[model samples]
Target: MIIVYHNPRCRKSRETLDLVQQSGETFEIIEYLKTPLDTSGLKALLNKLKMEPAALVRTGEALWKEKYRGKDLTDGQILAAMEAHPILMERPVVVKGDRAILGRPPEKVLELL
Candidate 1:
């Protein structure tokens, strides 16, 4: 089974979801904005993704630029920020088994298939 941490408002995320649907693979879509991940959950996701907390952050978001940019933050701090603001998280994180990847270009989800 594949799990997609999706943001419907994001074009890339929507595209990724479409691809997953077209592939006819069993998948679950998690709208993280409506139901945010807790710190531990985020940590687990990061482990699956083999990604640092900073790598999961959407640094281009205005909230990040205004509040978190230029700050030297620890991994915990970054995770806390993402929890507090789910919009800060990067979109279309696709997971299969223990592995996960960000679907920035949408096509990246194909790797899992």
Candidate 2:
């Protein structure tokens, strides 16, 4: 089974979802904007992604820049920020079992499939 942390508003996310659907594999989509992940959930996701909390953040988002930029935040602080503002989380995070990948180019998700 696969899980996709998706934001339908994002084109890349939509494209990634299309690819996932075409693959005909059992998958689930979590709309992070509507149903945000808690701190522990974020931690588990980061563990699967093999990434630091900061790496999973969408730093370019206005919410992040306005509220969290240049503050020298700890890992916990970063996760808190993402929990407080789901927009700060990166889109189209595709996970399968113990591993995960960000679908930056959409095609990158193919590697996981």
lDDT of 1 by residue, 2-76 (tens): 999999988999999999899888999999999999999999999998999999999999999999999999999
- Give me the displacement of residue 46 in model 2, in angstroms: 0.5
Per-structure clash totals for the candidates: 0, 0
Worst window of 10 by summed lDDT in candidate 1 = 104-113
TM per candidate comes to 0.97, 0.97
Model 2 alpha-carbon drift over 4 Å, by segment: none
Report the backbone clash tally of model 2: 0
Judge candidate 2 at residue 39 and give its lDDT: 100
Worst 10 residues of 2 by lDDT: 59-68
Report lDDT (Cα) of residue 56, candidate 1: 97
Every model's Cα RMSD, please? 0.7, 0.7
The residue pairs found clashing in candidate 1 are: none
Global Cα lDDT for candidate 2: 0.94
Count backbone clashes in candidate 1: 0
